[model samples]
Target: MGFQEFLGNERIVTALRGALRTKRVPHALLFTGARGVGKFTLARMFAQAANCERLPDDFCGECATCQRISQLADPQTLLEQGLAERGESADAATVERVPLILQSHPDVWALVPDPVRLKSPVARPMLRVGQLRAVQRAAYFQPMGRRRVFILDGAETMRWDVANVFLKILEEPPGSATLILTAPSPYALLPTIVSRCLQFHFAPLPQAAVEKILKEKTDRKPTEIKLAAQLAEGSPGLAIEMDVEAAAQRRRSALRILERAAQGHGFAQLFSDTSALAKDRDSSFEHQIGVFYGLLTDLLELTSKVKEPVLRNAPLAKELESLAKSVDSAWVLRAIAGFDELYVGARRNLNRQLGLDALAASLAPAPSRASVTHS
Candidate 1:
């Protein structure tokens, strides 16, 4: 899609279009935002615009250059097409094992994190030093198009060594090349790296925009689309990819924890529940904590008696309202604070059951101290 068709972040679009028109694009551009907020999409669009032969400030999308760049932008589609060409299986396992980079255009290169050793399905992909070295070698070469565009998707996945290598390339960048790096935030990268580039912060899209995109992209039901849009909180990418049923189940589980805490369940029962939930393979502990936080926010809104409360878990309004009656606003506020602490700790490798148990204890009413009879 052209920049005009792209949803949200109109200001960034205008700035990029102006840059293309002026032929004064930055050598190094950093796009930072939350995941699924259109940073990579905009980066790809900018890359296409930079090299589009027919249009100076925007891509024609039908040109040979734009078509090839589009193919390079969508790594998954390129991977599938390549596998089909080679008569290889395009199954989930095979796709997972393959690295996801596409250089369909001589002037465009899209680099993504790849598994360091490809040992297991759960292994996290990282941007290695070798990958940056290849880009550094290619950046100096004259572009087949107007500009050689190198997109480093998920730049935060780079280890310090890899980032240092990338820093060297940025230090002595080629005039013919433009390097685009995407990350969740500038703070996630090295300060030196942040200082070297023209930074663009992508804010989350509006709920209406997210819903519109969901309608266009997904075959989900209207109810599901609305719920996912609300849960996505302005991220069209997240809304499109969200599993409504899975999210509902997580919210239900979170509500159950609140109910048990309100009923003053014993530590043994709470601990047992926590252990079982920890063992659930359907979702990660981090995701569970997020659901819990969302529920706490809803409860706080309900307890505060907000007019027309906006809730992330809107479908569970009846259940949440009932629970809110059992507890006061102060209780909900304390739970929110406790969950916020647990959420921070979720980043590190902590024992899941212990974390859940701690959250449960925090939610439970404090033990009433009884006066002991004088002996």
Candidate 2:
């Protein structure tokens, strides 16, 4: 629950830690990164570190100030009080604990449209104008805690009005207030808003880090966790996000596919897997799709020995190599084209199961549209 406990982003930890040591931390900091990359966690830690009453090195968790701040016990908590009551630096452990509750925190707000919208016709979430209005109201209030940190979880959902509401605050934010905003990409944010805050870019975590967390957090077999981690594209958030059972099942299914493919697997099993995934009509559908995508990505990574797992076309790798050796790269290229389009179609409105079925059928060893090349 401290900086030491933070799973990834060591450089970020070091920078904030350094700033706290010098007591020259900026008032307006924006933590931008993919979801679940520890931006929010770091923000809360930084908040506590700025005002701990402990020794110079860090916040003493046992201090009266630390106790009050850590538990959010004080209603009248002000930034100066938080800073004054603690050690020269606040306890990172205590602050990190706060973010664990951030999703449900009343004061901590998000304006994103529903994720289920991806399942909707539009496939997009809209951050309404009201969310921005709340930010205005929060800004008008004095510090709720030692600092009133406004963490916009899905900043990309910000509508034009929402982004505009931020312009004023970002330009002249309250002295005691801090904004720890997160988004998948800054390109989605307004350049004006981007210009205002001290932006902290968070890159993806290492695959090893993702694997470690997945293994530790899930009761799934080590093999299953490793598969998910590999396919997760270094996103620990994605790995931790799986419900243990669903994640386990997905891993099992994917491994079965890989095991079969390794052995020049039959087509019926792939068809069955695709059909089964498509049958999940409720919440599990998204998980199934994500798992399927991750599964393909793992196979793709295995094919090229490419360190990054961005390719979800991996299930087709064996065929790719065969075709590449026998024919020109054209056939492999077409296979990729077909799947990429299929992925896009699934992402939009096409039936996911059908897409997977089509993909599976195409990749099948027998009667495939693709003819393998003999080396």
Best by lDDT: 1
The true-structure Cα RMSD of candidate 1 reads 5.4
RMSD to truth, every model = 5.4, 10.9
lDDT of 2 by residue, 9-67 (tens): 78888887886677565656667775567665566556555555564435565665455
TM-score of 2: 0.57
Local distance difference test, per candidate? 0.78, 0.55
Find the number of clashing residue pairs for candidate 2: 13
Best by TM-score: 1
TM-score list, all predictions: 0.78, 0.57
Off by over 4 Å in 1: 79-100, 115-122, 258-265, 272-309, 318-375
Task: List pairs with backbone clashes in candidate 1.
Answer: none
Candidate 1's residue-wise lDDT over 314-352, tens digit each?
A: 778899999989999998888878776775555444666
